[model samples]
Target: MRLPEHFLNNRKLESLVENQSSFTLDHAAMHIFETHQQAEQVLLQFDQPVLASMIEGKKVMHLRDYESFQFLPGESLVLPSGELMCIDFPEAEYENPTRCLAMAISEEKITKVLDWMNETMPKTGGLHWGLMDYNFHFVNDAAVFQILQRLVFLFTEDHPYKDYFVDNMLRELIIRILQTNELKIYGSDTFTLRENSRLAHVVRYIRTHLHESLDIATLSKEACMSASHFHRVFKNELGISPVEFINNERVKLAVSLLQNPEISIKEVYMCCGFESRSYFNRVFKHKQQITPGDYQRLLQRSMF
Candidate 1:
């Protein structure tokens, strides 16, 4: 899908912020910045650290409290909050200008997601690490490139419900990150899923039983590991505990249901596995920043 003309026309890189811009729910807090010529080092001081995966090109990052490193396309990097960093593009030759996607997400939002995980699955703590940095060689990884292209189109589009589409794309992008991690863990000749393996069986179990009542014990049993050990392995592999993973999936389902005007909030609650309407409302509102009814109204308004 091509980006709408309006969004493209409205694109303004806010320079005053000094490498950062205000956050917006309209597009998953992501931005694509391109440079035709090598520019001076870009310094960014973020309120919260970011998990950044490179989509294309090469860049060097000087991170606070971490060793400086060069990130090629298809590599991932994590920048912790309050940390200052300098990013530079050192490559001298490029047929096309270098491009990168800067996804700025709130630590608070991520924490909420983590909180949901602990609530639904008490055994799981959460991701111990705060950063995810990676590079993707889009030339070789055509599939990953295609996903990024789709996102670019959505971001440039001017549709009334562009934010909705962008949010969906963001979800897809994150899923791709998980897939990348999976491939990295399992592609090596020595890759193994022993008790300490990041590719634990619990994640697969949860994915298979989304509609079922899944808890720490059930998931741990599926992995044939103790609940505590399972939780530790899960957080190490997926960046979030098993419980948080389930709630994120549930919220994703709830959002899909809310998009359908025919589906009532009460119905959504039951369908998504929430036993109480009030609790569903609370969780949905906290994650989505709006009540289910209000979300429906916004969707309707966008349609018109």
Candidate 2:
């Protein structure tokens, strides 16, 4: 998950201070905002729904009743159309200004995409497309980041056939955004999307049974699809293979288990489904950048 720093740096302009530089096409717009001086309570509203991503520096966002939070690099916020956001540039200075992009999207284009998704790939168990709502912040993953970077190129291009390109990219961008949103809400209390989606059903199964031996065949059965078909669809929908996702979920659980100083590192790994200590240690360090024992000690120190 590297941030799209190249696109961010390329888009920056010298006149930084609500300079209002934007590129627009048929169904989407990219607004690049840079603030050189510290500012507070800067009001920003979009006529269409916007996916605001933090490019550089940081911002203190105050949206609706949600408490103030930092919008740092490698993060994004999906907002509804006509929503007013009050943002603060607390760290903006002459040398280091806050840079962000607000990509306002056309409702008509979104509706068309939504209709197509529901019609073709209709969720078997839950809601269809139209995943965009009031949910604000999200971490940028590879799929979402790549399409967004492509869009930077598309928006800046003056080619006459750019509209066709815009149409294609807009569909992709919106779909990726929707998928990102769905992933965000998957297991949380707000997750109500039950499209009978095979990938989602498989994912839901994996989340519930992370401690068990979840082989591909068993998971495929939960999705009611053949093993090979399930594998392809799972990776396509979620951007990760079934095995990688299992390990990710296990690692997430391991982090929580490590917080308990009473639980030994060996016990933590076993509970999270790792077969051996060496393997567990390698995976833990790879994902968390620290050994499980070190993480446990860090947690132990914090308790005091």
Candidate 3:
């Protein structure tokens, strides 16, 4: 994946604080910012998947095509790449005005870490422990918060070995995230059955083939189940029917494609696996509650 040109230009730098008070990190990284200034819809674009955690103050984190989460001092929120997030701060201010950190993790690095842990940690059965759903909150322990504080200090301070320290600390931070076991939703079951596993396989397949025609019968066959049964089980497992899930995934791809001015809407429609422009528009508007042109305009407004 081609990262932004600025990212390539600042590869060697550990941290950059822009005039807008947002910080950027180049490594398995987190951008930390603290400000009392009221933000007018702060939107961030990540080249890699990112986890944004609010270490201080109450803030609202909203993600497109996912869920929204409210973070207190000790809570953290996770966001995937190509996801647009809106952060809103409380109107009444006390001690601070939205101090948060955005951590970016390379997909390749995460895969390698998961593979290593799968081989080394027999109990996990090759499952990636750091996998988090969009907009979910994980309460941080004291140790984790301390590590984050140290990282912030290292990032802000001009120490001689800042890069070395930051890299080692980031590795440790990933280990902490892997070891965390506080993931749960109220009144939700945590077990997986054979049927649910099949549904998960279907979801993974859809994600992998976002640019291809996703027929229900083909997907059902891929899951080794009848179409009716697959639809029922998939809806039960993922809280959405298979077809809805596919359309949602396509809309997500469409939003990403719309970010590029070079790609025409027609080209984006075909590239994102829409059969026709009208169908794409219909689905996009139905999901986003706005037409693709309006969505692009919103993004452009945010850019300025």
Candidate 4:
């Protein structure tokens, strides 16, 4: 997502490389960085966990365990405390600067939220609420994108009760981020399922039967629980409802199918168990910020 034009216009031309403007709240601090002119091997480190979101232009990120990769707009990276970053700017210029927002959050704040979550809404299969200790880079999902946009506004604007608003937002942001991370792990082909756990059995069932009509009653049977209880437990454990999880799985399968040039969009939706074209488009667009057809076209252009 793009930053407000007013914020961009008011930036001071202090440095040609990685210019910084800072804003602070009680539990976190946000720094807006703008870089002009090509730069290489620029080092950055944080004392607290930092969430970095790209706003404009591009960067080549060199981090542990990951090969150098392009950091583009609508992408984000999460780094743990004291993690070092080496960044490269191949396309920075006076007229075309690379802009990014880095938000550093306190460890205590994170710990408090994690403790509360584990106590009140414990995850299934003995999983605990926590953040990844290593660097995590991902495309901005719709929920994350919306939260980041609101956070930027809250941090940049002047308000007497700024910390109160931001603190609440930060709690949600943390929960959403953890939920996204868990979804990635659970949805991965390599993630092993513990056969004894109810959630594992239900997840396995859902994955295998995605092409069929899935209802809560059927899924609850897989978990050996009633439909109402299963729904509540699933949402509590995963931070998403059973229906949402099903739709997410369907959309993910649709994405994989769409990559094949031989697969028509209709075929993709049908294979993913979508009842109609319009419903598929709406669900896919909501998650990915683009219609299935548009996404496929963009994919084709990139490949060719």
Model 3 superposed RMSD (Cα): 16.6
For 221-259, candidate 3 gives per-residue lDDT tens digits of: 988879887776554334346777788778988998999
Candidate 2 structure quality by residue, lDDT tens digits, 146-212: 7777776777666889889879988887877776666556535345554555666677788888878
> What's the ranking of the predictions by lDDT, best on top?
4, 2, 3, 1
TM-score of 3: 0.49
Of 2 and 4, the candidate ranking higher by lDDT: 4
* Model 2 Cα RMSD, 1 decimal: 3.4
lDDT of 2: 0.78
Return the TM-score for each candidate structure. 0.45, 0.85, 0.49, 0.86
Write down the lDDT of every candidate, Cα atoms only.
Answer: 0.59, 0.78, 0.64, 0.87
**TM-score for predicted model 4 compared with the true structure:** 0.86
Q: Which has the better TM-score: candidate 2, or candidate 3?
A: 2
Question: How does residue 138 of candidate 1 score in lDDT?
Answer: 23
Instruction: For residues 145-223, write the lDDT of model 4, one tens digit per residue.
Output: 9988998898877789889999999998888778767666666777775667788778888989998999998999888
Number of clashes in model 3?
0
Candidate 2's error at 50, in angstroms?
A: 0.7
Any residue pairs clashing in model 3, and if so which? Answer: none
Best by TM-score: 4
RMSD of each: 16.5, 3.4, 16.6, 3.1
